[model samples]
Target: MKIRRWQFAAIILTIIWLFVRGVPLDPQVIFGELLLGFILAIFVTWGFRRMYEGQTNLSHGARVLPYALVYVGTFLRELIVGNVDVAYRVLWPSMPIEPVTVYMPLRVERPTAITTIANSISLTPGTLSMDYDDEANALYVHTINGRDPASIVAPIRRWEDLAIVIFGEEADPSDPAPDIQIGGDIDGE
Candidate 1:
């Protein structure tokens, strides 16, 4: 209470609230929306702050902005590319489709980081997040064409790196990613 964690939360939450409101181009409208978000975020952060207790640093939200933005851009690019690749495979018929599942160990131990990475995998075409082994902090990802596990895991590792920063997880992004294991069964193949 003395450090006013709520102030930091309010600032970060206000930015998120404004974003969720679809930032308008008009100056007056933008100011109005920001004012409303500021008020709401204060209540929300203060009211719900009990859930955020025990975190090592509650003030890292602003520092996370750049990494979060980069993660979004990277995810978006992979989404578009995956969609095109999947569409081409669907249309061409002869395109290679060697489905395979891989187990990827993660440096990010937090649920938020793991879930973000898992969801990103599922959202991208030709890949699905079948399961997560929480004990190991790893994901089971199935890719349509995974002859090369490295290729399938490259973007995911990128996202994980960003998520570690965004979530303020204990892991260091500079640390090498764990070795991936080819795993699971895709139609018994």
Candidate 2:
């Protein structure tokens, strides 16, 4: 296995921490600690890239940094707005909720990009990413007031495209769908 720089650092740090803790350095303990440190280093590496499916060796320079910043900014804004909206709806019972499920087709091909879109939708108010059918490559999202699933697709695809810019690689968004439906209503819910 090719050891990443960070993984090596993690292993060293773990060993140092264990040594500083004054644990008795028996042969068994030393072997166990080495094994534990190795495992922890691997775990850290995996966790850092949990979103990605395959090995990601992209240069983290101008190409990815700006888009990542944008993604964070947009996500924070949406999260705050969604929190306020959900709170307001909870406080004011007059808010109308048209519960509906939309079969939202995604253009992002990379697993990480797709996951980010799904997570962002679920995080925002009034929407939940119910499931992703890998067989059909589509998402089932439930929304509080969904009037047009097609319209929502545009915004979601936009977000995914930006995510691709940050994470690298995505399917083209120009592909067309027959129709987007919500709650078995052609008009949407």
Candidate 3:
């Protein structure tokens, strides 16, 4: 509900509107579009103002950009690596794959951070975030290979390290990650 929060949302929406509309040829038209886009964006942001209310640290906000950039880089790297691994398995029928569910307990308990982590896991290849245990604050992740749990977990933990700072989460990266429980039907049953 804060003006500052609404302002940021409106500014981002205006940028998106511009991208979707594309730049006009004439100078006057370009200026007109920008002005209209911003006006509409402001109104739209105001309409959804309630959704912006959540735990936010203005101090952490300033530091978040750098960490966010790093997290994106890590995510992309993992995405590419996952794609290659899945592709390899697809090409080679003889490749051994042990499918299992991993219980990944998160250090960050905030809703936004938890959702981000869950979506990121689901987005990556060969891994899916199946369910969330609210009481344990843990996620059940299904991966193509569980024989080397470290390989599957390493990237996720790296993401968490950056996410902690990016989302202004209270969890510390130095805190030990809980031992992940791995078990599932080994066969494709």
Candidate 4:
């Protein structure tokens, strides 16, 4: 596997850190770790972007920092709130469970961004992305308690706007449409 510069640099820096910390490092083990790290990095990059041709730009990489911070902030807050919400539902005799599946229409065009949003929603508590229908241009997500399908789209779309800024900019939401089709299922699985 071809080694990217950052992957090599990360390996080198990690080795140096271990040395500075007085951790024993065998030559064979270090070589193996370097190879493994490089391979994993390549795979991760490919999964993130099918069109990414390994053009490593340090500047572009830095853009992820702000996006990551925002995502983490939102994730943590939602996680805590979700936990409490679940706890309340469990403890209450009412057992407030809507268990609804929403078919959300997507406005984003990039597959990577759309997938990111889908994955994020799935990862968050109380919701799961079931499927996608490219022909219908929509996403089917199962939510623990939702009043309507639009509820899923609103929050995800907001985060998607932030994600667009984090990863790459696209056409305005108000721009004329090309009738891209999509649809999906909401089984929370």
TM-scores of the models, in the order given:
0.76, 0.64, 0.82, 0.61
Any residue pairs clashing in model 3, and if so which?
none
Most lDDT-accurate candidate: 1
Put down candidate 3 lDDT per residue, 153-173, tens digits, no spaces: 898898888888887677799
Q: How many collisions between residues are there in candidate 3?
A: 0
List the candidate 3 regions with Cα displacement exceeding 4 Å. 1-3, 18-37, 54-59, 184-189
lDDT of 3: 0.83
- The better candidate by lDDT, 3 or 4, is 3
For model 1 the TM-score comes to: 0.76
Q: Per-residue CA lDDT of candidate 1, range 70-114, in tens?
A: 999999999999999999999999999998889888899888788
Best by TM-score: 3
- How does model 4 fare in lDDT? 0.64
Tens-digit lDDT track of model 4 for 1-189: 355555545544555545554534687766666566556655654465544445455576576778768866776766676677778888895976777767666666678777877888888778888888797667777788865545445567666666666666575544443322222333233
Which pairs in model 2 have colliding backbones? none
- In model 1, state the lDDT of residue 102: 92
- Evaluated at residue 62, the lDDT of candidate 2 is 55
Q: What does the lDDT read for residue 18 in candidate 3?
A: 76
lDDT of 2 by residue, 73-186 (tens): 787777787688778889997987677888866656778787998998898887789999797668888887666555456556667767756665644434443355567752
Query: What is the lDDT for 28 in model 4?
Result: 76
